[model samples]
Target: MARSYQDVLAGARERIPEIQVSELAELLESEDAPLVIDVREQDEWDEGHIPDARHVPRGFLESRIAGIADELDAPIVINCAGGARSLLAGVSLDEMGFRNVKSLAGGFSRWKQDGHDYTVPSTLTPDQRARYSRHVRIPEVGEEGQLKLLDSKVLLIGAGGLGSPSAYYLAAAGVGTIGLVDDDVVDASNLQRQIIHSNDRVGALKAESARQTIEGLNPDVSVKVHPFRVDQTNVLELMNEYDLVVDGADNFPTRYLLNDAALMTRTPLVHASILRFEGHASVFHPYEGPCYRCLFPEPPPPDMAPACGEAGVLGVLCGVMGSIQANEAIKMLLGMGDTLAGRLLIYDALSMSFNELRIRRDPECPACSDGAKLEFRDYEAWCAGERGHAEAPVSA
Candidate 1:
């Protein structure tokens, strides 16, 4: 004789022990809260689910559960759309030798009906709270701003001098996602200023070197490595993924490429450069102020401006310049304080003084001006002196 669907569910219910929604709500407030796993699909989870619930859909539960939490004896609670699926999940986990697993009674439906709140997890650990205590104590960057830092994605264009200190502080501040682009490897000569890369990382790709240092500083950060140099072809697409762009590139070619890409994408760009004792920092917001081009209009003659390697930079100057860039980036993400938009901040370490210059947007600017079309250019060739002018053709 064939069994009815209700009979199968009845059998599952007997094998699965459950905890009431009310009881679980109370348990969540305790120190020994069980790991809550949502077994719903992506769409359902996105709609609304319990706060801090680790999502592992039923289909992939068995394969991923151990990776999510290894202690079979640790208390675990599984939930779904309603009570039925959760019961089935409990039975499966029970058979898998999990010692303390329970289904959510009445599931999400009853929990919602009871006026329990639903939220995505903030994912902050107690250690993080203590680690970022200084930032939390600040009136401007209190707990809320700290949370924003943990949610922001910042793209850094290089891992050289400027990128080195900038990436370190940004990671320390708990910027959740940091994307790094650098094709060069860590060279022994870089030790003087590229503080993020150590002697052990010599010959390793700069992006990976930076990753190791940042991961060591704060495990909460996620570092995405682009192990290749930025060019016109992929610059725009790369900038699109980040909330903002930080130009730490050492050369004019990359600087121009990043500037155009940021303007075209309408993304905020924190621009900074360091040379010897003098360093410059500014924010180029596409519409709010002048883009990088509005100030220089074109790269200075190659003879006039040489790479830091050739010209020699004061090692500590990178720290000052990069820290300022990080400060500007944090301000932009938190939307606090007046930014460097339409103004340039120049720092001279020799004199230990700072100067500000006012810049205005050029209505006929090729990058951000109205009706100005963005185009891809051979930046390497342009920077290599193959082209006398800085402008590139417009893309169709």
Candidate 2:
């Protein structure tokens, strides 16, 4: 027998309980507030809705409810533009084995008429929505996370091997502001690994070349070019200006300088180093995890550690490691999945293997110890073994 629309509504009203707007408002402010789900369309939701309400359109409610609701017995309040839709939504929840579901009496319309608080959420433009459609579809990096990425700023300490891929992917992901620090001009040799630079721009400053590439990749990202080497004099200021730093410096002095400055500024650092067929990457989250100095108490003897130029790095190794650095940086920006904060990732392309080593905060680390005083030092001399292992006297 076919049931009339009025008869269907009557059956739903009998199965679901309705809570008044004032009662729902009071419950929202209590210690045991129920999860408020707004079953309105996208346009309706964008206009305004109850503060802290989760939007699940009526069409998607049945399919997406499980993802939003944790338990069958958990209290849930369903609401829509008017009372009828919410009552129907509650009936569906009841049929789906949800034990504690209630419809909002008179729904959002009544709540608004009663002068309750509401929120107007920020939405993405059509261009951004299309550009980052893949990212927006991810549950971990939905529109909210995409917006967060757009508001984030990242600083790449070098525009060479590691910085090239890191900057490229970060820009592609719509990291709002990217600061490129490099004083060197692109050399013919750099073309092997520095993909951000082109043959036509061989003699151009690396920072400028990277900026051009990044800007060309995404108009949403603002590229700030700092055509100077990062030294003790300006490291802290530069670190302070950005939310996070991607350490692509090829030398130990710059690495140590960045480590100490990062501690002082309490900034997160995404670190990666590549040489030959091997690469190592880690995340130094200020005092939260082990820092660069914590892993390497002192720079290795000059003869033991060599730069990629001298040792000759595989071009693709930079892409692998730099892409890892960018991944770690984006995870940090979005406050998502566990980053490599307390672990070192070693990638050996020659062996076709990867290894991980746990890293812990050093209690007596010179740069990040509990009581150690941090100050800029003669990093170049220190890394050169001209100074002793103890922290050198503060440089002027």
lDDT of each: 0.87, 0.91
Where does model 1 exceed 4 Å of error? Answer: 1-123, 385-396
* CA shift of 154, model 1, Å: 0.7
TM-scores of the models, in the order given: 0.69, 0.92
Give the alpha carbon lDDT tens digit for every residue of 227-324 in model 2: 99988778888889899999999999899889988998999999999989999999999988999989998898789998887889999999999999
Worst 10 residues of 2 by lDDT: 387-396
Write the residue-wise lDDT of candidate 1 on 1-396 in tens digits: 998878888988888788999999999989989999889875677577898777778887786677566898999999998988888888888889998998998888888899999975443466876999888656467555788999999999999999999999999999999999999999999999999999988999999999999999999899999999887778888989999998999889888878888877989999999888999999999888999888877677689898788889999999999999999999999999999999999999999999999999999887778877777676767767766453566352
Error of 2 at 91 (Å): 4.6
Report the number of the highest-lDDT candidate: 2
Local lDDT at 16 for model 1: 77
